[model samples]
Target chain A: MKINLKVWRQKNNKAKGELKDYKVDHVSPDMSFLEMFDVLNEDLITKGDDPIAFDHDCREGICGSCSMHINGRPHGPLAGVTTCQLHMRSFKDGDTIVVEPWRAGAFPVNKDLSVDRSAFDRIIAAGGFISVNTGNAQDANNLPIGKEAADEAFMSAACIGCGACVAACKNASAMLFVSAKVSQLSLLPQGQPEAKMRVMAMVNQMDAEGFGSCTNTGACSAECPKGIDLSNIARMNREFFSANLTGK
Target chain B: MNWISTFLKSSIGKKLLMGLTGLFLCTFLIVHLSGNLQLLKHDGGLAFNTYAVFMTTNPLIKFVSYGLYAIILFHAFWGLYLVMENKKARPVQYASYNGNANSNWSSRWMGVLGTIILAFLILHMWNFWAQYKFGTTPYTQYERNLATGKVTFSPFTGEIAGKMEKFVDTERNVEITQVKDLYAIVADGFKAWWLVIIYVISMAALSFHLVHGFSSAFQTLGVNHKKYNALIKNIGVWLFGIIIPILFAIMPIYFLLLN
Candidate 1:
């Protein structure tokens, strides 16, 4: 398929950016969206032009590194998928694709397509973990975990820390991301020691990162590559409220 | 002053304000539509004009009417102010926004939707309120009469005379008043299918605007948590999207149904 692209380009965090257009031809139907970009990059590099820069370590969708908004949508127009996994077949023969950097005040554009998601990392580090002391490997049977709790915990833990939720949200709120992490840990006994503290620190970190408050637009779950439910958000709210009041 | 501050401060505070104001506006819309519905009622010219007079002259309602004006302005300005700052507050989004982007498309376009709704509001006020306030209204039933037994008609003058009938309520029979030619005005302007069509489209625009505004308002006010957020969002979509549209749509449909 023939394609036209309008992509956002910038040098670094402080640079002003604008959309630059490009044309690509002979895109194979089977090419993964990232592979087509690889073809585009090769052409740019061979011609002595700076290649389009985007973040992608793993071509598989799990890494959440293929950070590019195609046609005003994150990860292109497809749902429940990542950019790395998107195929050229989804687009038309001669479509004009408007590729943009992820927009939200917190996630600044690092270059073309690649954004500085260190804010997410900072929020995670703020309280995403359960603190435990060194000890011998404990028996798995020691903690009496119920099936429902274990399943819920696993689901929450499935979040890949991608900022897709924030990008999709009208308010650019990280509540879904922050809450999912909190719910994942708080559901289990191992996380009990730091449960309240984790939610408090993480939510504060989220706010400190200058993300907007959640407006429940539900855009986060819609854009989530992992299908993380907004239920995780509700649980996070419960956790945060309890944490603030109980001081436990 | 304190009430405005109450709205801005806490999440609960904001939620309460959004909910109270939203529900209040909803009430006003229904009442406004009901009075307009009189055009299709059996009383002919008398029904609509009488309803219009009652709305304007009733002292209690007139006082409450002032609050209604304030609500529209407050909701409009505050929503814009928040969206503008929010745009600045989060400059960049995550690279891949999301495939699911959720159910509330209108909420995302609140700014644009609000603008359209505002334009409609101005048109709305010009049609009914301005005339009730500044322009002439029938002081007595006899003022609206046939010139002779042969039956008289006032020549439809301009858009000025067509204002009341431009967009009308569908639910009840409204008194379409005397104009340059009163019969020609109601039967021609409103009873004509084309003008009714225009009014229907405008109501639809209002509907889409409310779809997003309703849920977004609750979220803004802090209708948070796992248990209640879904309820709040669902109610928002239904009330704004479904209920309001139906109410507004009913007015045009009822009028068109009229002989």
Candidate 2:
């Protein structure tokens, strides 16, 4: 299948970007979106031009390293799948695809279809973990956590920190990502001691990163590859409210 | 004090304020719409006129009206501020953005919808509230037979009197009440085709705004749960979005075409 591409290109974060068009002929229907880009880059390199630079690590879709705003959606048109999981079969032959980096003040464009998502790292570093000792692995039943709580915590823990939520949100809000992190830890027995501090610090870090606030549009969750629920955000709001109310 | 200030400055706290103010305005809409529904009563504007007088003069409602005005201003300006900050969060927009892929147009265009509603509010207040309080609102007198419960009304074109006056005619077993005819102003205002069109269009915008705003307020306040989300969404869409706005739009249409 032949395809038309309008890909964003930038020299660096300080440089301006523009959509540069390229045509890829003889594309396979089974080729992943990133692999299709790889083929495009191969062609560009053969012509002595700069190959398009994008982020991709685990081609199997778990690393969350692949960040592409393809065809006006993060990770393309398909729901609950990363860019690496999106195949060319999703598009028609001779279709024109627009690929751009995740657009957010916190996630600056690094190059063509690549962005710096270290802001998420900073937010996580604020308080996304517990301070348990690492002497040995504890017994699975030692904690005696309820099944419902375990399931909910696992769901929140499924966030890949892909920055797709920010890309999808009109406000570029990181509430989904932040709330996922807050929920994953706050729902666990090990996460109860510093719950107040964790919520406050992580939220403060998120605000300091200059991300927009949540307007409850549900766009982020709709575009989320992991199907991260918006209820995590509501949970975070409850946590923050109770934390502040207790003056902790 | 310091923590409170810091909390309010945070993103979630800002949204909490938006939600609180938004839900308050939602309640005000219910009250305003219910009261305005009196416009459809076929009592020669007597019932509506009496309601207008009561709404303006009742002391508790008067105080609540002040609070309502303050809340509206805060909601509008604070919402504008949030929109501006949201714009700043993304300095460069995507060259090709199809927000409809992930979210509804109503959710994405809330700021624009809200601005339209604000503009409509100004026009609405000027047309009815200002005219009722200080403008040349006419007066009408209604006489009712105490025994039969039959009532009749006519224009009271005599000298200026208080907002309302009541007297009993024992000989004829009738009661008389005179009131400022604010309903006449409303009926006349809706008589203009352009005004009715604007009213209907503004209510359309209000419907879209509330469809997102209602359940969104609940989510912001941490009320989102699997068991209750569907119920909340249904009420938001049907009650606030469809019913209230349609009922409101019908008023102008009813006055223009039916009354």
Candidate 3:
């Protein structure tokens, strides 16, 4: 298959960016989107041109490092899948794919498609963890959490912090990401100790990080590669509301 | 003080304001629509005029009306703040943006839809609410004898003409006092095809706005439950989205076509 690619190119965060076009021929149908990018990079390197700089690791989609907006969608057109998992066959032989980075004030573009997602790290660091001291590994059944609570907690924990929710949100809100962290901790018994404090601190940090407010558009969860639910945001809202209503 | 400001300034806090205000406004819409539907009565606007007179004259309702006005302004301004903040959050635009793939069309175009509704609101208030309140138009006070069942329309030219607070409890009498005749104003307003078109278009935009906003405001306030989320969404999409807007739209069309 022959493909036309319009890839965004930028020198640095402060530099002006533009879409530069390239064509790749004889692309295999089964090749992953990143692999196809690899082919393009190889061709660019062979021609002594600057290769496209995109973040990717462990191409199996678990790392959450492969961050690129392929054809105006985060992680391409497939639902609940990463860009690294999107195969070339999703496009036709003569398709033109326009790729860009996550456009958000919090996640500034570092290079072509690599963005600085340190803001998410900072939000998590604000209160995304429990502050309990651990002596050793506890027994698995010691907690004895209900199946419903345990499953919901696990689902909330599935967020890989990919920033796709932010990328896909019209407001560029990190609510889905922040809420997932907030919900994951607030649902567990171990997390109950500082639940109120955790929600308040995390939400404050999310606002301080220059991210937009959630409008409940549900785009974040829809474009989320890991299928993180929007209910986590609602849970976080409940947590924050309760934390504020009652003293923490 | 610090906590209050902080909570109010936080993302979820701002959302809470938007949600609470939105829900309040949604309730106002249903009430407004039901009252407005009285324009369809065949009794020569008697029901609608009487209802309008009751609404504007009652003391408790007057206080609530002031709150309703404040809520409307609050909702609009707060929404503007959110929209501006979101725009700044994504200062750099995507070269080839496609917002529809991930979100509903109404969700993405809410700001636009809201702007349209705001424009319509300004025009509507100017035509009816402001004139009804402040305009020096003459009003005919209707006094009906409760036992005799005879109704009289007299030009109520006095301090009480403007503020008909005394007649708030006179439900038994068929005394028809012509206030600003808002029903005539609305019926006449719809006669102009362009004005009707504007209203129908605005209602359409409002419908789309409500479709996303009705459920979205609750979601922002974290009103999500496995059992009830679906129910709220259905009501938002069907009742507020389809029924209310369509009913509101039908008023103008009915007056235009029938009256």
lDDT of 3 by residue, A1-248 (tens): 99999999999989999999999997999999999999999999999999999999999988899999988889999998999999999999999999999999999889999999999888888889887666997788988899999998999999999999999998999999999999888889989988999899888888888999898788899999989998999989998989988955
Q: Which ten residues in a row have the lowest lDDT in candidate 1 chain A?
A: A239-248
Which stretch of 10 consecutive residues in model 2 chain A shows the poorest summed lDDT? A132-141
Q: Please, what are the lDDT tens digits per residue for candidate 2 over residues B42-78? A: 7877778878888988999999999999999999999
* Alpha-carbon shift of residue B57 in model 3 (angstroms): 1.8
lDDT for each of the candidates?
A: 0.70, 0.93, 0.87
DockQ, model 2, C-alpha based? 0.87
lDDT (10s digit) by residue, model 1, range A98-208: 888778788878887788899999988998887766889788899899999999899888788778887777777788888788888899998988888888788778777
Ranking by lDDT: 2, 3, 1
Best by DockQ: 2
Highest TM-score: give the candidate number. 2
CA deviation > 4 Å runs, candidate 2: none
**What's the CA RMSD of model 1 in angstroms?**
8.3
Q: For residues B153-222, write the lDDT of model 1, one tens digit per residue.
A: 2333344433244222244332224332232234434565765676677777778776666655544433
Ranking by TM-score: 2, 3, 1
Which candidate do you rate higher for DockQ, 2 or 3?
2
Worst 10 residues of 3 chain B by lDDT: B160-169
Give the poorly placed runs of model 3, Cα more than 4 Å off. B136-180
True lDDT of residue B109, candidate 3: 81
